[model samples]
Target: MTSENTIKNQLPDAISARVRSAKLSEGVATLVMDATGLARPQAEALEADLRGALEGAEGVSEVRVAMMADKVKRPIIAVGSGKGGVGKSTLTANLAVSLARAGYKVGVVDADIYGPSQPTLLDPSGQKPKARDKQLIAVDSEFGVKLLSTGHMIEPGKAIAWRGPMTGGALTQMMEADWGDTELLLIDLPPGTGDIQLTMIQKFKPDGAVVVSTPQDLSLIDAARAMDLFRQAHVPIIGLVENMAGYMCPHCGEISDPFGTGGAQAAAGQLEETFLGRIPLAMEIRVSSDTGQPLAAGDTPQGQAFAGIARKVSDWLKAKGSHG
Candidate 1:
């Protein structure tokens, strides 16, 4: 074969060998990995190999992994869960708020279309987003974070009936909304490892992702799946967070692991990503979230938790620089 043909033939092998499979769709070549049993070191090793291979391929305009679910303008860090109800939304809200308060222009796209929690977690009394020249304008929370959510578009009851195409379309619109000079966009993805999740990552092409889970075996298992999703999407897995890891009692001022702690941290180690931090199960976090006010907006335990996470995230981003 000619040298050009030889290069082309070698490209597919380099990519497919690193992943479970590789395919070209819509002029974009993508690599998908099962990544079921691989530990973090193995995954990273595989990713490095794949990156090197793709970097040498000719005629490859874009190479995407099958795991990123959203297409975003800025560097986006996704906060995802394997399943729902592990405080992913709460953590996302507070983290975004904390980042915004720490002098970064932050925007949050609540990609949880089926359960748009940011509307409730951000500010219940907050005004809906406005459209300028047919483009949606993200609303600003009291803490100065720009926000967009499916919650602002459809009623909660009707959102359940939205089909996959509708969800994808809405997510595209929300993600593409006018964030207005934001430095970072934190996406609060819907729970699951399904098509919706995959599509969101591919479209948004987030810079990295953070998985959130409670410290239970079941939640950790799901978090592993979530991490795998990002891995497959070829998006970098930034870290994992153990939410509701422990609880601080208000009456006696003591700590207890209602959910049995450390599972998430262990999982992150196994996966070879950084273990971001833990958020204790505090009544204050729940109350503050429910009231459309996150704990990170003020001087509270929850605020400190989010602030620390934000700092870590900002530091990491500073180190990585810009993607596009």
Candidate 2:
């Protein structure tokens, strides 16, 4: 007979009933439970508790858990930028929304340690994520996108002064969070080719990475560095997206090259990869993202740009069979 304390320690926190445990020939342990009619948030909570149960189990190299589901399916993508200020966070938030709009389970990991903007880009002014078993519960942003950001973990007006180990530790927590039924995990990496980026790549083993850049030559050059970094990490480069590529004058019905157009596209060509598309220098995209209602949620020029990029992203993932 199992003592109450032993049972409580072994069982997941939110397990409504007995959990079936099995050990596979490959040494991977499987934990099964029932979660019918449970909401997404509750499922995430259950996942965290179940994962904790197998953390210290003997000879367990990996643990797989299922809750009222026959199989698991989710594709994780990493989005990187050469440097900051190219609207990478905005693009990440919007792109995640667009992918969800296409009926895929989506989540965004704001791994941008230096400047995490997901909290501002996706959630409102006063919202914050609460902790369950010291694990963060990813806030539900609109468009069915769940968001977790480093910015949300800090106090207001405080800077995160972290060394390589600290930053990597924080990132690990965010990546290992209970992302229940997430079909696509989009990681918004910090700009620049730094230790944090490399560490994240090694830890997560993302399926592919999307590089974001502006039309300017310097940004494009930085974007190339990002592409090379991912290649070195053995992660495939999905495609390149040109943000703020140009401006369309609504009043004059003329288009102008604000950041000088086609630089990202040309760079993608040089790298022998697909150039997803370009987003114009539009006010709607800026205002909407800033207001926590990303432009991709509606039919705007920027929204269309994000949709096009999402389609290209979907097609590329499908071609590589990464979506499975």
Candidate 3:
């Protein structure tokens, strides 16, 4: 067979799918890829295909595949849990606010497909997100971080009873929403390592994950399970956060450990993960979040704690660089 025919015969399936036509001259193979609506990942896949196939083809010294597409994939970090009421959503909201304060264009996706609470925490006014061509436009929040959530799409305080496919679809819509220049995305995943978590790990693919749990043995066990899911999926663990670590009495100067202290940190150590920090069980944090005013939006102690966590996450992202 001729060199050109041999090269065409050995083209990869990815190249065959995209190439509308192909030509060869000398030792170089040229391909006109029909990449009309491809995202960045698709274009990258095409590039990989050409590099792998044509580079090894007999007599082909170079390959050129021109692609046309209009999209980029941004970094996504997931804040998740193994069970409910671990304060993951609150932490996600405050972390977003803190990261925004630190000058990173951050966005939050409430992947809590069943128990989404980010709308209540970040955009409590009940403003629904707009859509264009079926892609959601993240709702603007008073906290400066854009948000897309099932909570935003549904009525307030109602439970979501969606099954697998429906939940997966909603999470995908939020995860793939138009986040504009948001450099960092925090997805507040639903409690437990279930379908939503699996979908995110397989589909959305967060750059890193911060697992949240209370300072208790049971909660720590569950948190570890969630962490294992991310680990198995090859997603980096940014850190483990011990929530409700200690509570200080309002009227007096007494510190209380209602959920027991240091459990999450010790778990992190055993798991060989970074301990991000602790967030005290504070009435101020609850009140602020309920009022659509994240404590991180202020300069209070509660705010400072979340700021510290955000800084650690930011440092992780910086260290991880463009890959994260």
Candidate 4:
């Protein structure tokens, strides 16, 4: 008595929506399975489950599952800073590399129209992205990460003094790239809440945002404003990261806190937000990052710091259970 409709109703609730069509003929069951947004392992498991369920049904001798994945909507995570000097862009680069190293398919969009520094950090050679079918192509980096930045299209050291519409258009072009298999797209937003930020919220609608700030009251105040922007737009605030919390002198072995640490954590506590972690003010980190070599791509102390932060962010998003 088992038929196509019966088998579909018996399919797991997880992939029920993916059942495009099903048919049964001569004791052979055929199913059209949509695996969009599913990871490779997940797709494989789904196929097995479908086959088992169909074969176990009455009158079903063989089962065939044709798996297909439609174009998936990549989740966006916007990383913003209160002010420009809090090393937000640098953190974005390292975080992307860390996530990629952890086997996550990740890409970055340098959405900082005013000051696009990601090209220097990710692609020092100033490589330009090629276009096909009127869509931009993402440049592959050495750390197994993909990147699209306004810096790659503009001249170095030149200011991008454009109006709101121009800036929004550029951001659109960078985002419309061929980011194949990229599950997570990290947008390195420009400093503060402005037209660019508003455009992103209104158009792209990010899944969440991570605010970066230094361990100082001034920067923390700005960071609070940035978080409020995302909150107003109904975007979830993933957490806050305190950068430049401490600095150690390699020559004299002296530790210093010139920026007066813990301000960002205290701010997060007051706002009842999750305080992700901190990054130290290390000279090696600066040198390595500025030279197109992200510390998070290597096995060093600074790299571990960035990796730790990446894991927390990644886990936080995964807990939401929306993405595969």
Tell me, by TM-score, which candidate is best: 4
- Tens-place lDDT per residue, model 1, 197-296, is 7777777688898889999999999899888888988988888989997887788978899899888888888888899999988888888888887888
Can you write out model 4's per-residue Cα lDDT over 100-138, one digit (the tens) per residue? Answer: 988888899999988888989999877899887898988
TM-score of 1: 0.75
Identify the candidate with maximal lDDT.
4
Ten-residue stretch with the least lDDT total in model 1: 64-73
Q: lDDT per prediction?
A: 0.78, 0.81, 0.85, 0.88
TM-score, candidate number 3: 0.78
lDDT of 2 by residue, 9-63 (tens): 5554556264644444355667666665355667667778767776675555676
Per-candidate TM-scores read: 0.75, 0.79, 0.78, 0.80
Clashes of 2: 0
Clashing pairs in 2: none
Q: Which regions of candidate 3 deviate over 4 angstroms?
A: 1-70
Cα lDDT tens digits, model 3, 90-116, are 999999999999888889988877777
Which regions in candidate 1 have their CA more than 4 angstroms from the true location? 1-73, 156-159
- Higher TM-score: candidate 3 or 4? 4
